[model samples]
Target: MNFCKRTDLILVLITAVVTTSILGFALSNQVVAQINGTQQQNQMDYTGFHSNIEQIIAHLEKAEYNKFFNNNTLTLGHALHPIEEVLTLVTIPLSTADSNLNDTYFKDLYQLSALASPGNSTVDEFDNKSKSSIELSNEVVATVIPATVLSTTEHNVSVIKDLLTISGSEYKEGVAGGNIILELEYQDGSAFMDRAYTLFNNTQNISNDTQSVTKLLSDFSNLTDSVQSLKEPAVIDQIIQKMNIGLSPNDNSTTSDVSSSQTSQDYIDTIRGLLNEVITAYESNDKIKAKELTTIAYLDNFEYIEASIGKELSDRGEALLREKLREQIDGNASIDEIKQNIADINKVLDDSAGFLDSNPK
Candidate 1:
């Protein structure tokens, strides 16, 4: 249920909070009064937006908790929708002068919120708008390259080149082409390199921590075994690749393809639905129906991983035991037996982490 580092997403959110710092800038009483008919209602709306932001935060936290167990994005997106609405409803106070500059971000969020998902287009739009506002200028255009980013990111290269051309400047060493001049920050590479190194190390350490994985597994069911030993090397590599995407600077292949037909959230809902169906079949004493639900929902998902483990009594074995035990429960196995089977599976999963450690990818 781990999510890769979402630096870009977090940046979008963080900037939105203080983006309206211009609201506190010089506002005439007339402008303020014209914007809000009543001072009391204005105060109320301000207070309400604050409360709404908090409520949205609660939604994200709850969604994250669900994701920790289920790895469901649908659940997360469902929660994000409310906050998106709140961001939309927050109108900019009607200050005609400099309002376009001030309201640029609020305007952006209005569109971002309406999207079914703030997919790549919305995210890129927001990023570009936010960046251009702070850095770009029609009068003063220059090519500024960081040593680290120049080696990668073809898009950024085109962007800088376009800025140079638009400025109508010809370059000959320090001689400017029109108004465009190349201004390079020669020492900027150190800070970016340090940040990249730190991110990689921190992510690797967290993913490799046996205790943390075991603790996470413990929460699913109190199966007490060290989890580092049970870790899957391929899975670990997948995780590392996901986490290191932007941070690595040169790792173009870090991104995963969305090949699973169902969205993460949809997949989760299907599993949950099957679990409910299994419960219903068990309650009705329909052994065949219960097995059908369990096999389709859980067993099929694990079948690929089972073969990958390549061991007799590894994670796969424990999973098979749990699946069979669940079927046995439908056929009148005792509750204690069910618990025992789960515990056994937990131990096996935990030990498999060690096997993963020994066999590195």
Candidate 2:
């Protein structure tokens, strides 16, 4: 009996060891399979992240290029700005994944998407200015010089057109990536926005005159028409007509006083006073001041005509006239242009002779 019990106990111990080995092997295999699955998941996640980054980089490039006249001689001297092309590429190890990269990359994708405006985009302005410069140059070349010897002609022509034609070849000659004066995206860090807004606003700023000047012009236009109906000074009447009041040869100003039911004699006096000074400048042979005042007068009156009677002449009126005045005031006016303008004014004045005797307020 004692021998039988000892054998049974040894058999039980052997079975227990076998069962433990089998369970341990199964557990070890399960751990290895789990580890392999995790590695595969990490690789897929890395690939997806990389793809997202690539898409973002692509969109940023597209938006940036749209914001400029690329490789423009008048604009930045570069095939592309660094902000448009350069991106900081990141490679994350499997042991380390960066959360900041994920957040920033996604945000960039949203901003550079086509759904956003990018604000004050230079795309239209640059395209128009650059293309218009070329087209206008071609037109002037055709109009001013015949097909006969246009290549050898030496006639002075459109100021902007000449600048564009001479500089057309310069667009392709710059470094591939030059220094960027403006950034490629929206920015609130400064008064001026980045590349997009900076470039579009630059050309417009040069053309924008002050509100005070614009208002003074409106006042003068109204006063000239009022002075015409009264019979006092022939010289003043001629001056009123010569100023191009309401853009008519006859002085007929657009009245804004219909709502208020009062005509302004003060505006008349102010306009008369300014003309009095202009007359003095012309009479004293101060060509510079006369030209300056004439430039202001032309532009101001033109703005009035543009605001009032210029809807019909929208395509033809005031544009070239304003540009000419801008050139005169900004010192780009040629001596010939200035002399011609003065001669036109003098012609009108000469038509109404003996005007000094009929002058009294």
Query: How big is the positional error of residue 357 in model 1, measured in Å on the Cα after superposition?
Result: 4.0
Compared with the true structure, what per-residue lDDT tens digits does model 1 show for residues 1-361?
A: 1112233455355344434333433443332111111122323232222222332333333333333444334333423333322332232322232445435534443333333132433433433432342242110111122334333334232222222111111111111222212221101111122222322232323334576444433322221111122223233233333333322235353212221232323333444455555566556654433444444444223322333344464345534443354446434666455446545554555555455556654
User: Which regions of candidate 2 are displaced past 4 Å?
Assistant: 1-279, 311-361
lDDT of 2 by residue, 70-141 (tens): 422212211111111111112122102333442333233222221223232356644444343334323323
Q: What is the lDDT of residue 147 in candidate 1?
A: 35
Displacement of residue 169 (Cα, Å) in model 2 is 36
Q: Candidate 1, after superposition: displacement of residue 20 in Å?
A: 66
TM-score quality measure for candidate 2? 0.20
Model 2 residue 316 distance off true place after TM-score fit, in angstroms = 7.1
Looking at model 2, report the run of 10 residues with the lowest lDDT sum: 28-37
Q: What's the lDDT for residue 152 in model 2? A: 22
Tell me how many residue pairs clash in candidate 1.
17
Worst window of 10 by summed lDDT in candidate 1? 166-175
